[model samples]
Target: MRSSTRFERDAFGPVEIAADRYWGAQTQRALGVFDIGEERFPSCLIHAFGLQKMAAARANLRCGALDPVLAEPVVAAASELRDGRFDAHFPLTIWQTGSGTQTNMNANEVIANRANEMLGQPLGSKFPVHPNDHVNASQSSNDSFPTVMHLVTVLELEERLKPSLVLLQESLRERANAFANVLKIARTHLMDAVPMTMGQAFDTFARQVAHGFDRIDATMPRLLSLPQGGTAAGTGLNAPPGFDVFFCEEIRALTGRNFSPNPSKFEGMAAHDALVEVSGALNVIATSLIKMANDLRWLGSGPRCGLGELKIPDDGLTSSIMPGKRNPTIAEVLAQACMQVVGNHATITMANASGNFELNVAKPVLIANLLQSIRVLADASRVFAQRLVQDVEVNGAQLARNVENALLLVTALNPILGYDKVAQITAAALEQGVTPRAAALSLGLLDEATYDRVVDARTLAGRPGHRPEGFSERS
Candidate 1:
């Protein structure tokens, strides 16, 4: 018989795998049947799982269930995994793994095998401690998976999203300051209204992002409230007296994860309101991003045919067939990411409803979707800010041209010319191909110098009490 067959025959029951394969026949069949590519779950999630195992192993040591011989290796493996060292061991196909049992066992077997190797033992041999009894001593997937999800999400938010949000806010503030002096016609309901400074419009964008960041940060405290210490059924069955508190503390120490005992372990295991809150928060931020990106897209629409107020960098062709075409692809991506976040939130909501008394079987789906939302929001925020917003050039000439062309600037003149005369001058300016000032002068509504002084966009956009020299408020 082949060495692989002999090895399998000695170690396992009638089932066996070929010598060339590390996994058994079941894994081989799963690999073939699912044939899913190397696309495993996020590496961060896998790292989180490893961190949980390490934390649990350390907790077990504190509980007198594991010796340093075993605990040391677990901690080392976890540290390596967290630093992105062992990626090959994480390629378990997601489809064939019913109930994620294969994945759980895979993690166990990988860690055990690695620990054994560290102890100068052959691979595939359970050493001084077993993978299940010692390493996963007091935990179940019901507890561990969700805990990992929470840890990864919270860490990503703090480490990645928070900084990116600050950068975006800074970018917006810079734009607001740069455009502080430019004036543009304000529109309500897509119709012309009074005048406002371009600074105000940019400031509004900054305020929207700031509010989203605040809301996201505000939601962090809720996320820190975790579902740890809830063992199989939240009863802490088979767990030592102080295991919950001590384990949470150990987790905090090891992973820098500040987890607390679920106030009601029963409710915690039986439901996922925390995940719902997270999803809701992500949806809110995604909605904000949609609004902000759409605003940029519309504001930067056209140099010739559209709004043409701001110009965006040309990253890609807007249309494949249209000549000289460039579209707001980045903004479009933000819109799509926002839609995905909304859909992911809906998925989380549905998954949250799937829990029974003791456990929610839809955990995999919830974690998957929730992580999707986090990654898409984080990545899209970074790209939209860096690629599109930061380097974009403002079309000051076009802005001035449009402002000068706008008949709405004449609204201020309405106070001087009466509404009828202002409307007539507006029409004549359009028809006679002259400046509103020249048209007003032709019609004797006002002199050239006075019209110029009073119709000044900057003076009008100034504070209510402020005006240019020789210009007085009508009221």
Candidate 2:
């Protein structure tokens, strides 16, 4: 029988690798040593490594640091890797070296071995395509991994998260238009405060999401700046001069993004402040989502006993033991997702502070948390828009009843009558369990004609024709 494993040698010694696997000795060594976590790098990050390796090879070839013969197969293999042809070849966890050096070498070994195989050589042969000498030419994990970090971040944000946010914002705008005339009682500090249209509340949510879009836009310029040619210690080391420009140019050409090299490579590798800024923005978004979600859950609390202002969508899956109970399942899910993002931002902030003098040793955890936040937030935003926000119905009868019974409707009387008088009326209404209009008349605070004219909920909700900027009411 054929042997199941074959021997591959690196600087340390020879190690046995699976016969069909493409990764070489260093990756196998990492597998043996850092077997702590099951959290392997995601496919997007692995694909980013593929693009980085490909861009590096092209840059090295342009800078005369690599031979054309070797560049050919390296580029081909790297393109395949970028397209996810060899996803299984990468098996290292995020618990490895802080610089992600082992994962970088994993990419190099897989690309180099694949390139060698394409040239009719065995997998372990460090022949024409050496993993370090050629495949990783003019690059170091310190610089390259951070470059990959920025690339994946920008791609995920622009391609996934931002679009989902836009969808949610538009969905909220639609809801605002749909409920623009439906006046409801507003609460502040968990007490009845005043009257507001449901449209105004949803419009506020839309504006919050719009601000989230602006925050993400503010981070783009810094995130697009890469530090590829910094190499091991931000010294450029063995990398050729002008390699940074060439690498970014090749990356732009390959990915069609306007990526440029950072003026200070040391800052890029040593401080992940840009990523921290992104996490801060994500944290703000998480807080906003939590506010909206909690408000929704409160408004949609119950059909019989709770606020009953909103009718949450029923997905045919009610509470396990309580039959026919419609819970705010989507809002709860979204709030939980936002909570995780908030926790992720805290982790990212702490990880970013772990940056030392020349290199941040917490890169793997940092990027992992960042990407996880982006992905989950994006998915949650989409689900919130499609599953919950779009299907929510207004409890018009309940809203009317609440608005009629609200003691805070006496707020509209404050401008006409004195504040103390309005407070007395409100207190009497609460004490007698009577409507504010009845309380005002019974307390002789105002005549019935004046109270009816002043305490109208619709007029008290604020001016009509109020909509978020750039939003038009749909017919």
Candidate 3:
């Protein structure tokens, strides 16, 4: 039954390989052992590994560890992988060996076979470019794998996630400035508290997102440090001199982002604290998004039922039974996405703590969650900003009515009418279900003219010695 299959061998012994593919025996063994999940290392990770392998081959050649004849084709093959040519070849799951040994070997075999093909040799020749002796020469899964992790994470943060956050922040800021004239009653404990401009409320959300940007910036210096020369257990053993430096140089060239070698390979290989720090920043961002999203839901709720202080775009989502109903589906999406990010952050934190003396047994999950957090936050921010923030319409008349009915405007009345009188008026209004202004007038706290000037929401929010629109203070 096994007679027709092609055989490949590793140091372990002979094995079967996919007939048309380039990967060798070790990758095949990993595929057979660990097919538990559908989650594969992303193509971004594969591309970074290619970049690393290509750079490693050149560094080995320069350091006199690999022959130039092998180096050329390896470089070519590695370049193709880096350029995303063989992304489909990286089929190993994220559920593989903790150090990502299987993924590393997968890269090695794919690059080797491809390199040998470029040299007019058969796929498994292992001649001009042996997967281990040449392409992975001077590196181990410990150094190479984590270096790729850092590369993809750093690039994604700068290229996509960070920029998306800034975009969302700017969009919120623009709306904040535009909404300054639109007044609303602020809520505390779900009750009307005081007068705050719509602009002020939007600005608060912008400030929260801006703070998240600052938090992430603080983690960059550590996140950009590569563990490339650490080799197996951080001992730089087989990795030749200049490998770390060259790897950093190559990284800078490819990404246009600055990176440096880890000062201690042992520290780099043994722990994943940098990624944990990133997850913490992402956790804060998730909370910020949750606040903003929930606030929008409250503001946009009930065109006829709840607390509809603002109008959101009816993105055509209708209740199954009620054809006229449009719900806050995008806000719900943001909330659900934020919850996922929070959960993933917890996973990453545990993964960070799960490391033993030498290496984190959960580096794969740690980076996986970290990257997921970045991408989800970035996406939610973009969608919320465009669909929700940009289109949000303040129900100014309703806000004004709520402000007039709120007993808390007694806060403004206190300084003018004295605390005892204002307190008496507030209790009287609440007990009688009367408006605070009416209660004050009935109690003879002030004449109608004085009450009008002193208790106006516009005056309370805008100026110290303010008058109504037509009042003459001198008269």
Candidate 4:
């Protein structure tokens, strides 16, 4: 190990740390032991880690628990971490300790070393600001990790995810209003059932997205409840009096988000139902996006053969094997992204359940999956809004052709000709590949003049100013 340069000793004995890195002995121990997947918690959490520690330092300083000489360097080091200057030091995998203690100490050690260095001390010197004793005072891994989870999730939801959903909803709403007069065949069981305005179809999808947004809004209060005051099995032992309240206040100032302590620290520590609730709400959104994406892909399936209600926006990609062929690339990728989020919710559910009596040990997996879900959902919403949903074109000519030829249009004649007569005309129309108008004429079910006036698709779709076949309403 390069002649054991820059050794630091912990309870585990002397271990070598990377010479240029800021993390110390405990973090080095974790790096040696856990060699799981390369996927790490994102750098945003590192920034959150910095904000959390800095809040603790400020809280302790205000309460006179920390000496000003020792606290200033810690505050400065934490600001660097929060500002994203020290993300490289937090390279541990997401599959580390169950309570995220390794990641916690990872943050702790880096801050301690950086703080000491600011005082003209060497890298390994823990004199002025010891990692756990000074940097982590009034906190524990159990409380601190979960608190950062809340901070990162709530901030991202407010700043990124909610606004993206609004953009998507507005895009869909615009299309609905624009297509208000365009009539199309509505399908059930993949077969035409009735006539309806295309606006109705797009409006239904917009409502689904709006409903998902409302569901998430309802869960925000529960998600914002922080477990930071719990401090190791919800007991808050070895912490200064009134530290929890002060910590929450400092964090509120730092983030501009009021994250209050959970009413029951034992409940917060023993189960992660709040984060699971957030994931569940996101899962429902994933389901909504998946449905809309699949609908878009199918509607835009073919320029020549399929439903052809829509034309997908050109994404500048082509099939390497087929010439001049474009795909619904954004919608397809959106489906895949939503599927990953649904699967992540499953992982979170299991982790949420695996926690025991006083403390849940599956915090790292929960944190990893929750953050991943947020990123995927936010990214997919933006792409769907800008590239696909906003840009997709309605095939007006195709919709007109399909409505004119639809065998199901025979249903509109049911009241005049009765159900049996209309069914016969529908079967004949389907078998001969002819318009229902032609079948009605051949079967003597209606005259040419009556067929022309009665089969107006816009009238059958209940559009305003519709008058059917000049027959009196009382008759």
Candidate 5:
């Protein structure tokens, strides 16, 4: 090959970096801008992405698209990145480059650049393993990005979210068991109206969370499907034949994950339904989280001015100016975190629908949003279980007091004292500011022995005990 005289000379001088640890000016600038408060792009996501590329390269090699020597370094570099040894190579700022193109190029250059250094080749030289031709062989961001997204979502859901969700359900179940013996007033419209056990309320929450977990489980198979060997377009035109099948199989082996090739190349690269589906799964989770957290806030509301059934950890300062003040900050944070996930889902929903025939221009936003929902939900669920569910105490004394004072418990009397007499007793108790028991006794609705036995919280909450043959509990 002859050197091209048409090659532009003076393409500008070499770039300089002031920071010793940073990779490039673009990466450094990115680091400054998208500092939206996350400490780092999670190492798990990075590892999954690197492993994905390795799988693609290995597949390409098996198909005989590249020389063995070139494939060796590509595999080696990808393996290092997967194992977290090449952190500096992954230096693109989260905000730096749109389409994640800069970040993808950064990975290629760093891997190739490092491999060359190992081979005693001059830096910036692209020989033996060109970054684009060899390291990135038979793959493009078009396929690799979504493939990695699916892989990461599946990994996180299986490894992190599922276990924590089980624990959350168990926490609620335990609370339900503990509260089963405590009879309480069930309220509707914020007004007490009937008799129910605290156990039933807690049990309902546990069941709802379990349903959310089911939704996540249902969404996993779609996420495990990858689009990797499709290359620049969905046609797989640039990818060697057999590349897709081999890549999927190798990934399943390397990562111990069951991934399959997407059946429709055109569908895979044409749009990102996999991402949307997973996002929808996560949104379901966020919806559950919001419901659980809000219920906790309401149930734990007040010692003097609120429901005050359960206690929440005092993690925030309610008032800077007032002394001895605490707030339900953990629950508040959980709610806000769920809200953020909901917002991310909205963005993903829009992005998924916004794509053109060949590709969606909104990929960067899609990836960012998908990642945000995964991480936030994972962390928030763990925190909620540990801080709010596990550590908080139940105000059993308050529960008893509320149950005792509630006129609504008198509804149980309707079944025993007859509806008309029960109504009279409730009205009298309210007017006189006296106990329902006292009112019932005064009204001659029932004899003292019968009223005491049947109206007690234990009997009312349980199987609504049998009355002697002569007297009916149902009147």
Candidate 6:
């Protein structure tokens, strides 16, 4: 029978590796040492590393640091890695060496072994495609890991998160148009305040999402600045001259992104302020999402006892014992997702702050948290738009009822009756448990004709003749 494990040696010593695995000795050691968490780096991150390695190989070849013979197989192996052919080989958790050196070496070893196998050599034979000398040529984990972080951040934001935000913004705008004339009672500090249209509320949400897109767009320039050629420190000691420029050119070719070398590699390697800034943007988005979700939950509170101004979609989720309990499951889920993003931002903030003198050792955790925030926020935003926003039914009867009975509508009488008199009318309405109109008449505040003329809810919603800009007049 064939052996299940084989021996491979690194700078430290020999270690046993699975015979079928592409990773070598160092990866085997990391698998044993950093067994702390189940949080392996996501497939997107691994794929990004593949792209990074492939770009490095092409850059090295362009700079004449690697011969064409070795470069060919290395490029092929790294491309395969980027394309996810060797996904199972990368098994290290995010809790590994904070510099992500082990993960970098994992990529190196995997690509080197695969390249060697392609060259008709055995797995452990590091002959032509040495992991460090060729596969990791002119690159350091400190620089390469941060470069991959930036690459993945840009790709995730542009490809996933921004599109999702656009979808949500458009969805909200559509809802705003649909409800343009549906006047409802507005609340401040959870108490009835005045009148507004449901369209105005949804338009506010759409504007918030549009601003989220702008924030991410503003963050992209910083994210696109890479530090790949700064090798071990920010000095570019062993890297060939112009390697940074060539590496960026190769990266642009691979990703079609405008990746450029950071002017100050030291800042890129030592501080993750750019990533923290992105996280702060995400934090703001999470806050906005939480606000919108909470608003929906409150607006959809109950069909009989609560606010009941908005009808949440029935996604078939139910309580175990309740016969027909329909919960605001989508909004609740979206709120929970945003809450997790908030927590992830906290972790990312702390991790970014932990950077010391030369290099940030918290790279793995920082990138992991940032990627998780982007992924979950993107997915939740899309789901919230498609599943909830598109299907939510406005409770028009309840909205009209609330608007008609709201005591705060007395503000419309303030111009003629004055603030103090309006306050008395509101107080009397509350204390006597009557409508504001009834209380105003009881107090002889004004004639019913003037009150009715001024307190029209539709007119009180906004400026005269305002109809949500792009919406048509109510039929």
Which model scores highest in TM-score? Answer: 2
1-475 per-residue lDDT for model 1 (tens digits): 4364523222334444443333333344355567765546777777777777877777777887678777898777667766766666666644433234455555665576567668886554556646676656777666666677678888777777767777777777677777787777787898766677777777777776776766776766666765666777777776666666767787789767667766776776677787788788888889888988888898888768898888888896657688888889999998999899999899889988988778876776677778878888888888888888787767888777767777767778876778998999889988998767678888997787778888887777775322235321111
Steric collisions counted per model: 2, 0, 0, 0, 0, 0
Per-model lDDT: 0.72, 0.91, 0.82, 0.86, 0.73, 0.90
Candidate 6: the clashing residue pairs are: none
TM-score of each: 0.84, 0.97, 0.93, 0.93, 0.85, 0.96
Ten residues in a row with the worst lDDT in model 5? Answer: 2-11
User: Which is the winner by lDDT between candidate 4 and candidate 5?
Assistant: 4
Clashing pairs in 3: none
lDDT for model 2 comes to: 0.91
The positional error of residue 65 in candidate 1, measured at the CA in angstroms, is: 1.9
Give per-residue CA lDDT, model 4, range 1-475, as digits (tens).
Answer: 5444598988878988878889999888888899888989988889999999998998888877788998899999999999999989987999888889999999999999999999999888887889998899888998899888888888878878888888888888778778888888988998887888877777777777777777887888887788776788898887777777888898999988877878787888888888999999999999999999998899888889877998889999999999999999898888999999999999999999988888889999998999999898998899899998887778999998888888888787888899999999999988998999989899997899887787778888886323235322210
TM-score of decoy 3: 0.93
The most accurate candidate by lDDT is: 2
Q: Write one digit per residue (lDDT tens) for candidate 3, span 217-260.
A: 89999988988898988889978789888878877877787889
Q: So what's the TM-score on candidate 5?
A: 0.85
lDDT of 6 by residue, 36-95 (tens): 979988888899999999999999999999999999999999999999998999988999
User: For residues 384-404, could you state the per-residue lDDT of candidate 5 as single tens digits?
Assistant: 877777766678888878777
- In the order shown, the candidates' Cα RMSDs to the true structure are 5.9, 2.0, 5.5, 5.4, 7.1, 2.8
Per-residue lDDT tens digits for candidate 2, residues 1-475, read 9889999989999999999999999999999999797998789999998899999999999999999999999999999999999999989889989999999999999999999999999989989899999999999999999999999999999889998998899899889889999998889889888999999999889888988988988998999999888999898999999999999999999889999999999999998999999999999999999999999999998888999899988866787898887888888889999999999998999999998899999999999999999999999999999999998889999999988898888888878888998889989999999998988899887688888888888898886438646753321
What range of 10 consecutive residues in model 4 has the weakest lDDT sum? 466-475
Point out the worst 10-residue segment of candidate 1 by lDDT.
466-475
Clashes of 2: 0
Q: Which parts of model 5 are misplaced by more than 4 Å?
A: 1-43, 93-99, 314-319, 415-421, 449-456, 459-475
